[model samples]
Target chain A: MNTLKDKATFKQAFIDTLPVMSGYLIMGAGFGMVMNSYGYPPYLSTLMAVCIYAGAMQYVGANLLFTGVSLFSVALTTFIVNARHIFYGLTMLEQYKKAGKEKPYLYFGLTDETYTLLSRPLSVKNKRAYRFYVTILNHSYWIAGCTLGALLGSAFPQVRGADFALTALFVVALVQSLEFHKRNDLPALIGAGATLLSLLIFGKDNFLLPAMGVIVALLLLLPEKEAKA
Target chain B: MTTHTYLAIAMIALVTALLRFLPALLFSRMERTPRFVIRLGQDLPKAALGMLVVYCLKDLDFTSLQGYLPATVACVLAVFSYATKKSSLFSVLLSTIAYMLIMNLFF
Candidate 1:
C-alpha cells in the first residue's frame, strides 16, 4: 500500500507538469522539423534533444554546425549563452539537496521549464516529488516530440514555418512570468530596454550576449528592500 | 556531420551535464547556503528572463520601428491586461491578434 501510494504521488506530479511538458513538446518538434529540413537525419536530432537538451541553443548550434564553425567557437558561445543557468542552480540548492540519490538526474533535467515549475510553491509532501516529476516529464516530452517529428519528417515533403512556434512559446513564457510576479514591472522593462539598446549597439548577430551580460550585471548590483511578508 | 563532430558534441554534453549536476550535488550536502548566494539565486531568473526578452526583439528593424507599431501597441495592451490581473493566455491571444491585424492592414 505504501509503495502504491508513492507511485500515485509520482504519477500525479507528472500530470501536474503537463502544461510545461506540452510546451516543450511543441518547441522540441519545431526544432526537430528545422533540423530535418536542414538535411540532418531525424535520429541525430532526436539524439541531440535527449543529450544537449538546450532548445534554442541547439537550434542555433544546428546552423553553426551546418556552416562548419569551429568547435572552440561553438563551445565558447554555448558557455556564454548558458552562463545564467549557473545562478539558477544556486537558488535551487536547498530543494536539490533533499533529492538524495535522484539528485544527479534532477540537476541534469534543470531546463527553463523545469526550473520554473520547481520554483513554485507546493505542499511539503508534494514538493520534492513534484520537482523530480517535472524534471523527468519535461525531458521525456521533449525527447518524445523530437522523435515524433523525425519520424513524421519523412512523410511530409516539407515542414516549413515551424520556427515561428518558438516565438509564440517565448511570448507565452513572458506573459506567464509577468503574471506570476505582480506589482513589479521593473525587470520586464529593464529587459526590454536593455535588449533594444544592445540590439542597436551590437547588431542582430551579436546582441544576445551583450544584452544578457548587462541584465545580469544590473540584477547583481541592484539593491532591493525586503518585502514585508 | 563527421565522426569528429559527434565526438565534439558528446564532449559538450558531458561538460554541460557536469556543470549542471555538480552544483546541486555539492550544495545539497550543505545545511544552509549564504544569504547573498540565496539572493543571487532568486535574482537569476529575472535576469535570464530579461535576456530572453531581448533575444525576442533582437531582429526587429528599429529604423522602421514604425512598421512594428502594432506590436508596440500590443505590448502596451499586454502590460495593462497584466496589471488588471487578467488571464495571461487571454492577454497573449488578444495582443497577438491585434498585432497580426495591424501588420496585415498597415504593413
Candidate 2:
C-alpha cells in the first residue's frame, strides 16, 4: 500500500519541497483567487490545477477564460506559453531517464519550478523517489493553493504586482546559473539581445514565439563559428 | 462542462504533455541526435531566462517614470541582493517584495 514507505526518502523529499511548497501555495492561491473573480468555483480551479498543472499558463488561461476566445487560440497560446518546457525536457533527458518508473509522471509534471530545481539535479541517495516526491509535492501544493485562492478570491480580488514575481523568478534563476556556471554568459547575452529585438518588433502579445525562434536559430547558427574561432 | 470546455482541456493537456515528452522521445534511442540540438539545449536556459525577464516588462511603459521606475529599482535591488546572498531565492523574494510594496504604495 505504501510504495513511498521509506521514511528517510520521504523526509528528504519533503525537506527539499518545503521552500517551493510555501511559494506554490501562495502563488496557487493567487491564481485561484483570479479564477474565482472569473466566476469559476473552487472545484473547477482545483480541477484546472490538477489537470493543467502549469501555474503561469493557468493564470493566462484565467484571463482568456472570460474573453470568449476560440478553443484553437487557447491551445495555441498554451503551446506558446509552455513551450519552454520542451527545452527542460531535452536538457533533462540524462537525469529523467534515471527516474525509472517515475519517468512518465516526471515528464508530465515538469513545470517551470520543478524543472528549475531538477535542472541542478539534487544529490540524493534515492534520486527516483526524490524526483517523484518533489513532483507530486509541487502538484499537491499547487492544487491546495489554487483551491484556497478560489475560496478566498471573493474576499480578496486584487493581487497587485504578483506577476512581477515571474520575472523576478527568471532573474533569480539566471543569477544562480551565472554564479554556478559561468559559461552561460554568451547564451544569456544572445538571448537577451534577441528577446529585446523581437519584443520591439513583435509586441508583447506576440513576442514569445519570435523570441524563442530567435534563440534556437542563434544557438544553432552561431555556435559553430565560436567553436572554430 | 460543454464540448468546448472538454475539448480545450484535452487539447491543451495533450499538446503540453506531448511537447514536454517530444525531446526525450526523440533523443532516447540515439546517443547522438545532432550536436547542434544538444548545444541548443545546453544554451537555451540562459537565453530563455533573459527572454523571460524582458517578457515581464513588456507591459511597462518606458515613456513614463511611474510606469518604469518601480521595476527598474526592484531589479537593481534584486541584483544587489543576489550579489550579497548569491541565492536566487532571496534575490527574487526581496526584489518581488520591493516591487510589490512600491506598486502598492506609489503606483
Candidate 3:
C-alpha cells in the first residue's frame, strides 16, 4: 500500500516540476557554457551545479574564480548573493516541520522556483514525499543541463560573448524583482547608483567589495515603508 | 592551483547552504523572525540584483560602439522581453543570442 502511494507521489512530483525542468536546463546550460568559455572543465561545472545549486551565485562565482579572488571574497559574495534564501527558509518553517529526516535536504533545495511551487497550498496527500521528489527531480534537471552545456561549450569553445549571458541573466532577475515587489525603483536606483559610484572611486580593478558594502549600508539606513499584508 | 579552485567551491557551497539554513535554525529556536531580518530579506534582493547587473556591465567601454553596443542592446532587449513576456528563458535566451550575433557578425 505504501509503495503504491509513493509511486503516485513520484508521478505527481514529476508533473509539478516540469516547468522548472525547462527553466533549469537552459539557465544551467548557460552557466556551464560560461564556465567552459572561461577555461574550466565540464566536471567542475557539474560539481558546482550539484553542490552550490544557486543559479545567479554560480554564474558570479565562475567569474570570481576566473579572476582568482580570495576565499573570503568567495564566502562574502555567496552570502550576499544568496541572502534571499533566508526568506524562503522562514516561509518553509511550518511546512517542513513534518518533513522528518528529509527536512535538511528540503531546506537546502528551497530555491526560488521550488519555493514558489511549495508555498502554494498543497493538493497532494503525501506532502513530504511530493516535496522530496520535486526537489530531487529539479536538481537532476539542473545537473543534466550543466553537463550538456559544458559538453557543448567544450565542443564549440569559440562562441564569443557567451559570457554576456550572465549579464542578460542579471537583467532578467532585476526586472523580475521589480515586478515582484511593485514600486521598488528607489532601492534599485540606490543599488545602481552605489555601484557606479564605487566603480569610479575604487576603480574597476577593485569595486565589487566596496559596492556591496555601500549597498548594504544604504539599504539598512533607509528602509522603505512595509507593504500592507 | 586545482586545490584552490575546489576549496573556493567548497567555501561558496558552505556559505550558500548556511544562508538557506539560517532562518530554519533561528525559527526552530524561536517563535517568529525578527522584524529587522525580515525587512533586510525583503529589500536586499532587488538592490543586490541591481548591483550585480552593474557589476556585469562594469567593463563596458564607452569610447567605442563595439565595446558597449552589443551589451547595451542586449540588456535593453532583456528588460523589455522579460517585462512583456514574463518568461525568463525567452528573455535570457533572446538577449544572449542577440549579443553573440552582434559581436560575431559586426565586430
TM-score winner among the candidates? 2
Please provide, for model 3 over B24-87, each residue's C-alpha lDDT reduced to its tens digit, 9 standing for 90 to 100.
7876766666666555555555666667678778889999999899999999999999889987
lDDT of 2 by residue, B26-82 (tens): 887886666766677677777767776776677779798888999989888887898
Report per-candidate DockQ: 0.35, 0.59, 0.46
Per-candidate local distance difference test: 0.64, 0.76, 0.77
Residue A194, candidate 3: C-alpha displacement in angstroms: 2.1
For model 1, residues A1-229, the per-residue Cα lDDT tens digits are 2122366668767655555555566667767777888888888888888898877677776776777777787777677656545655766776666565667777787776666556544543656666666677788888987777766764533323223233433454565555344335455556667777887898777776677667667766667635931
For model 2, give the TM-score of chain B.
Answer: 0.85
CA lDDT, candidate 2, residue B80: 83
Model 2, residue A99: what's the lDDT? Answer: 58
| Best-to-worst ranking by TM-score | 2, 1, 3
Instruction: Give stretches of model 1 more than 4 Å off.
Output: A1-23, A120-125, A154-192, A227-229, B22-31, B62-107
Over the stretch A37-102, how does candidate 3's per-residue lDDT look in tens digits? 998889999999899898879999998888888999999888777775765676677677767777
Provide C-alpha RMSD values for all models, in order: 4.7, 3.9, 6.3
Supply candidate 3's per-residue lDDT for A47.
95
**Candidate 2, pairs of clashing residues:** A33-A149
Clashing pairs in 3: none
Off by over 4 Å in 2: A1-23, A63-70, A121-130, A156-159, A162-164, A179-183, A224-229, B31-33
